[model samples]
Target: MKKDIDIPEVKNVHVAVVQEKHLEYKTIDWNAYIINNSDTDLETVLIVSQGKSETKITPPMRHTIAKLPARSYAKIEFLQEKVLELNNTFKVTFFEGNKMFDKTYVFRKNTINEKALQTLPLMQLRGVLVK
Candidate 1:
């Protein structure tokens, strides 16, 4: 039987876009936030990309949940290329372990604006701010 899924509320804190050679890797910071956007716990992670070339830097790993406390913060870094494959569009997936949450984001090497941000929410979010 299919079981119900419990997804936590996660808010993206910051994102760093790096351009190396002809490849671009985006590092995103994610943390648990209150439903009312009040306070957050201090729990974070540093997720780096496996790399851009066909040779993956690291195998796909599971992301642990950030039990963000109010007034605290959690940092999560993610490689955009992993979720959004080359030439592909935005994508969303369920992240499990420590906490259950959904990862909604996009991978693109273009301008950052309303048009780009608009595509973010479609993945189930208000909008993802790209830098």
Candidate 2:
């Protein structure tokens, strides 16, 4: 039965889009990161992302991490300005001990911009946090 299965609730993990300057290229780039705020490490971490709109849907992008240490973060990918106009989604799953957890974070169209920048958790960077 579905109720017999244990699907743990996801917490202390987040997906964020950060705006960073490319000193070498004299340009800027928007990067996605996965943050782990829990005290335990996450193993076999997997993140699938995509951009979608009523008229168009970008191909799903898959990113994986063998293990994510506690209280740290990892960069997923870079986003172009054009992609910023589409609804971006990040589906994250990982295992802590013997339990599995998953969560989806979505950044609505036109919401990933400088005006929405804020200090991110466990990192000294300013970016938009998926709500």
Candidate 2 regions with alpha-carbon error over 4 angstroms: none
Q: How many backbone clashes does candidate 2 have?
A: 0
Q: Per-model C-alpha lDDT, please?
A: 0.34, 0.93
Query: Each model's TM-score?
Result: 0.31, 0.96
Q: Write the per-residue lDDT of candidate 2 for residues 5-88, one digit (tens) a residue.
A: 987888889999999998999899999999999999999999999999999899999999999999999999999999999999
Evaluate residue 127 in candidate 1 and report its C-alpha lDDT on the 0 to 100 scale: 33
Write one digit per residue (lDDT tens) for candidate 1, span 5-99: 65666554333232222234353422211121233333443232222325433443334434444433232343344433332122223232465
Instruction: Choose the strongest candidate by lDDT.
Output: 2
Error of 1 at 122 (Å): 24
Model 2: colliding residue pairs: none
Candidate 2 lands at a TM-score of: 0.96
**lDDT of residue 114 for candidate 2:** 92
User: After TM-score superposition, what is the CA distance of residue 74 in candidate 2 from its true location, in Å?
Assistant: 0.4
- Model 2 lDDT, residue 33, Cα: 95
